[model samples]
Target: MESTTALDPATALEPATALESATALEPATALESATAPESTRTTESSTRATVHRPAGPVAPTDAAAVALRPLAGRAVRLDPDGFLGRWQRRNATETLPHCVTNLERDGALDNLRHAARGERQRFSGKWFADSDVYKTLEAAAWWLGHADDGRLTELLDEVADVLAAAQREDGYLNSWFQLMDPEHRWMNLAVGHELYCAGHLLQAAVAAIRGGVGPRLVEVATRLADLLVDRFGGDGRLGICGHPEIETALVEFFRCTGNRAYLELAAGMVELRGRGWLAEHSVDTGLGGSSFGAAYYLDHMPVREAGAATGHAVRQLYLEAGVVDVAVETGDRSLLAASERIWEDLFATKTYLTGAHGSRHRDESIGDRYELPPDRAYAETCAAIASFQWNWRLLLATGRARYADELERVLYNAIAASTAVDGRHFFYSNPLQLRVDHDGTEEDAARRQAWYKCACCPPNLARLLASLDAYLASSGPDGIQLHLYSAATIATWIGDSPVELRVDTEYPWRGRIAVAVASTAAAGSWELALRVPGWCDRTPTVTVNDEPMDAEASDGYLRLRRAWREGDTVVLDLPMPARLVTPHPHLDAVRGSVAITRGPLVYCLEQVDLPDGVRLDDLRVDPAAAPIPVAIAGLLDVPVGVVAHGFVEPDGEQALYDTRERPPHARRPIDVLTIPYFRWANREPGAMRVWLPTA
Candidate 1:
């Protein structure tokens, strides 16, 4: 595999330089410098420079030898009128509060309270219950910055106080460890998840501080970090977290506080992986049966040596995310190279058509290469979210458009499909094919449910959607690049001048995107690059000021550079023709099958859309014929569905074993209807298939 280092670093925006220049221009004596124009305003400190001025909290501070930089969350705001806008609003108004209620109902809050009181009784729910509360708190913190909800603020503060009070003097804070069994604390390193929960707490603390929610959580996180460093750093202890999460969180904590110790500890943890530490301390007990060995926890080989994705899908992805963070902050090119190799291997074999990963229902592990079985898929919602997180870090580290493309695919399909339209219920496992009359366990229900005992996917989806704006656009020294098309207003800097751009479009349903320059400084000139999706076969046409203009394309983007004026409009037209897609021949399950996709949304045939007397299993799609587009009303709240021509092959043999060759099969024309994969099972639970055999 080629090393990621081979890619040119110049393509990525040099945030450190941009931030340093902004800081240097300010006169020390001028008090107004602090409130200078957004373009000229430097970050709080010159030593800690941010890439794009984030509209949200949690900006990355200056680190050595980083690749790409992210735009400030505050610089971009959704228009509240686009496809993403509706989802964001739902996440804020409904999902955030609903998650809190579930947490309270599930005893997450009660466990914290009980632990704070030094109770010896076991807490309800899983061993990772405290982490769920912290995740919900993290989502709420981000939402507080986007929307003003006084009641939510009160809830956040109350939760923070309870968590702070629950912490031990030594900074240890795991409810399961305190309330369930104190003697077993840190003893079960193979699956204890102590550091994993700490990672979530640290992330929640960072979110709180950055969103202006509070500082108490920051203090709590710092004490916990100090405790971790004292325990794991240097010769004190050499074992890393069985679950890989704290490494990334510790790096963020270092960024927020400008503490080198935290950064060092994060790097140390990454280095400690693949060292047989877990194997040395392995005990024969955990969630999965006897198969839950060292490899299942990703301890079989070192991170850099492991060529393909393995073990638990979420754990591996989270570990890779932390590896990418360490590589960027510490300039570990070898580590980055390892991550790139793993990414290539994952896409080549492990990933599913819906951009979902993990195939083993037994342990939520990534099955063998090309071992994707649709009927028994264990594509957990948390794994999909983790894949998105890892891809986002890779995009920031490499400035590669492919990373953004994969992230977009996962977000639109796997992540979006995990939740219901109302944002209340969720799917813990998203399978491409759901058989009729299938008996599902609690976690693998055929339809979305209000809540689950494990309940990780609901809050995880909420947090990702609440912070979705940050993943839309990115800025560099040359100009701003819009990764995902959305209706939003961006307030960012082009060099030293402030540039405000308003984007208008009904994306994913239409192909046209219109971007207008709302405001800009006098004589400002910067290149505005728009991404041309890899799936688009037709050349995108661009027009400036309503007149067609020739544009240059490079590295998956069309570069438009010129001085801008108010009311100037640049329009890009991407053809939205529905196309049929097929998997590699090596994929035995879907070898001769094909799937249809329009725009970024993957379409699937659902039982609710099929005509009566026609079962989904007996149908075969005609790949040669064009699918008829039909406008359907009130189908999973989607506006349209596709009708494809196919044939049904009914079995004639009544005997279980047909020794003689079956008579010539009769083919009859049938109309097969498909809705967006994410919208499946919203109406009723039945059979659904993403890939159909061609007749």
Candidate 2:
């Protein structure tokens, strides 16, 4: 069977002239600078604020203003034997190196060399290929923060040196435009991706600065950022990138350097969007003359007026991340509220059962509410990563548990399902269901490939996994709040006093979480909050030092306050029962089907697990019987699987359409085995479905 066809990045481009009158909207007055002095600025929200800038990707100058503050990169360490620990180590050992090797092999780095040597005809890879190198470099920087690797260091130095040599005197650094289209700089904003590439470079530099490495790369990025500020900051050409990301990157750069200009530039850029520039020039700028109009670039409405997510899945999510960053830093309540409203609408209607987004493959864009189709889902891996990134920022800004819950859903399902067990192969688009005859050659094939022509998700995964620990926990005025469960050591400051703790758990498989207090600098009282996942049906049991504690949770967290403790322990037991989940009636795609879940993991049935002569389409789960837990090993060392009772019905007539008056389909009792959604496709490629029809 041939694969269902769809438009990919390569086919989306064509040669066309830029519209001279695209910038018709008069440049509006710039927003007042939101950045303040080097000293921390206390806000109306919180009085007890920490002076130090909170670490991780987001560092709001006013730390206490936000609901939760992430601990510094050096504060938390995952145990090597734990689940996320293995992922981080794998990224360091396999994925990181793979990205570096591919950049060299696939001509991303060589493009820079070509530009440096003034060679114009030999440019290679996509126009946005430079972003991949930046993302990979960021992964290296973050990994180097905790682990030392000679090979990664050498590669980083080599790349940084190439980038420095290739960069023009004015801090412009794109290899493609430099070598191929020098005269059209910033001419084709809709499809050029020049600013988009620069944004990734800035983010890589920010990571390097935060991780304490790559000073030369930092210098190069700073120079480039300075150029952007000079060109677009104030009373300059008023235009926004067709793709966002520079807004967030500039804000982070401002946080790192305390240069008010970058922050002002980011704020101005955010303000300048929705003014109909990209929409006016999209077709003229050679975007394949497609029908993806204003909404495709999110130029349909202003960010503040937009209520729901639209446009390309990755683009929408990336823009939202920058919006939130600008909102938090500038203390714009209206902007923040707009972001929250859009997020609420996105989760309520647009999101999929696997926490994936983007239903339309033609444009790689988010579809209408409840329009999710399992078989045709274009839940691009980059979109999943973008969703996680957006959710992480929302979590930090509002300290909302729902944001954390969304993060867990995407991470355990969509994001985790992206990479193969070997860490080399990856799925560009994650589909919940793969028809038995799914075309293996399609760009969105169900099976993982070593690399894609676009090849964005691999390095994106690397950077996320390498920096995963920072998203697990946060510190507030009183104590630490653990968002994601993992075996790790957390050391953070609480009002000038240091506190250390060790967490032990086998999460997503079991419910037992033991938190042991290792040391406390302050003998006074402080609080520790644990997130009670929204998926927990029964009341989670909690105990302190083996004593039952009846603590009522508020805002999805159980708070326990205590003082003067060493060797004291806290244990939380959340019941883990496999349950069948049903989709909303409005979701016609899988309305009659059900999905199985245990703890934080979603389970799916692969054809390889079916009995002989049983086709995946013929199986119907027995909704009355509960799914049973079974242990498995040797495949990525995953420990658990689900066994569900179902019936395998014989295929009906061969006709595409059948009458209801046909004879009843015969059924035989069958046991269907399901692995974690993330673990599927790691084995033999076969048909798989997360939503099983119920008998």
Candidate 3:
């Protein structure tokens, strides 16, 4: 890939004319002058009363706060011998490097350099271009943590140097506003995304610090955060970002540095939302009219008053994540309750069968209740990522298996579906059904692209896949809860006693999992909880030390409490049977259509698997007939394929409208091969559908 320095600065720096109004405003002050002295700022001990860290990936060891469970961190290692291990290896080896190359190729690096040079010119990409760089850095940090790659370490240092140099004296770090129009920094709060960029930067810093790389990035992020605290609060500016990602990022920063000021700032941002700030300051700033109005940016109501998931999907998910973070850290029941309500609303109405969120492609917003359209669905990949983030936080707060289930669904189906097998190309929008005549322009591309102009999903996917280990399990008072089964080993502390467990399984491909108690401190008995996925039709058969044990499941976990000696083993068998799933009656587009799902994988039929002259659109599955199993190698990244009995609707009179019923369709036993939904569109960009019409 070409270097960002190769780009001509003069040609790339053409300033957007809309920013001309910014010249009249006052310039920002220096960081030292803007921020309060260290002595005056609240210390970690002093602020612990108002806000305490909750147990989860954000605050892994803060057990003082009231949380249902505690999350495991980098201590849980994948065995590097299973399905997810293969993907993780690919992510570290291919995806992370590809993202770095894309960042340079797309001018993200140049934007920072140009801004640091005080060049008032055109920005490289969108107003949120800085976020892509931060996400890539985060992915690199996670990859480097697992693998000792000198190349990634060098890249991180190089990027951190550019970011540190680009930082303003007063800690303002948005390249777009800095290089383009510094005066208009916080004026366009509705769509400016300054804080959104800062949020990603903060997250990158946290990841880098935790991964033991790029301490300079941490300094840059903390400076920017301090600047934010000094500017946007009671004594400072009384407004929040148009986007809602910074709150969660700040909370993580506090967890990393033990600085309570960051936590308070995050909580304040959460509380400041839904106060009609955006609605009151609505102005036509050439970013298009807020057709959905303030609600589009989630400013219609306060975070505590919001009911349903609405507006932009990614924005709503990110905002809810912040809400969950603040609620958990501050022990705010109302905020958590509000988040629960939104979760219920989303699953009840807007969510798709493939665990995808959002409904409308035109506005990138979630439509009304029960308004999910398969063909026109706009399930953005970033929305899935945000959902995963929110649900993971929720799981930690409440210790709910449903939340973990939702996270697993989003991870396996939606998140996995967005990226190609090769890990280079990605899908920005994942629609349920693709037609032959569907235009590939815009977000509805038939196949994944190397990179999108928006370019959010690629790096987001990278970071998630790189940090997959953190989401696997969590430790509770009773024992360790294995949420997602895979070939891995979990090393965590159970009440100050070190415990190590080795789990071996084929997982989604096979339901048999064997977990062995490798080692533990000599002490009392600890309960081991294995999640029995809600998708299983029957109870999971579990055995302890080769003895059949009947344990009642509570909150989706089958607990086994016993004194464990080294080498003790537990085996769980969850029946993996392919089943046909149907949509609700109100979903008129796919009411009678059935989707195939086995284990956690949602299956779809593709045209590439059909015989020659067989049209995918004309096919109908026989609901009563069983789908024959066929071992097909390299068909949509799966080891097995299902040959379903279906019929191709014979061509009839091509008429726009017919008063009488159309001619009877000829019944032919056509073989329709099905593959996992995530693996679709990798081949010829042909027609595909998750829901098939029943014969």
Instruction: Estimate every model's Cα lDDT from 0 to 1.
Output: 0.77, 0.81, 0.77
What lDDT score goes with residue 418 in model 2?
A: 91
TM-score of 3: 0.90
TM-score of each: 0.91, 0.91, 0.90
lDDT of 2 by residue, 1-695 (tens): 01112212233212111112121111110000111123453221121222233357767775324788877655777776667877888888888888888888999989998987878868778888999999999999888877788888887788899888998998898998888778777777777888899999988887887766787888789789878876776845656888787888887877777677777788888887887877564334432434788788887888989998998999999999999888888888799899899899899999988899999999999999999999899999999999999998889889889999999999999999998888898999899999999885556886788888898889999989888988889887788899998877777767767677778787777777888877777778998999988888788899999999985678988889989488888988887778999999999999889999988999999998876677999999999998876666554566667788989887777467866666777778987778899988887879999999998
lDDT by residue for model 3 over 1-695, one digit each (tens)?
A: 01112112233222222212221111111111112122222354321111122122465325324445544335666766567877888888788889889889889888998876777785788878999999988988877767788998898888888887888898889998888777777777788888899999988877776665787877788788888878884635667777789888988777676677777888877777777877676454545456677778888888787888899999999988888877877777888899999999998888998889888887789989888888888999999999999888898888888998998888889988998988898899999899967877757889899998998989998888888877888777668888887777676667767677778776776677888877778489888989888898677788889899995688799988888888899988886667878788988878888888878988888888777888887788988886654445545557655557778885577577768777786778776778888998888879999999987
lDDT score, candidate 2, position 603: 94
**Residue 587 in candidate 3, Cα distance off native in Å:** 0.9
Worst 10 residues of 1 by lDDT: 1-10
Better of 2 and 3 by lDDT: 2
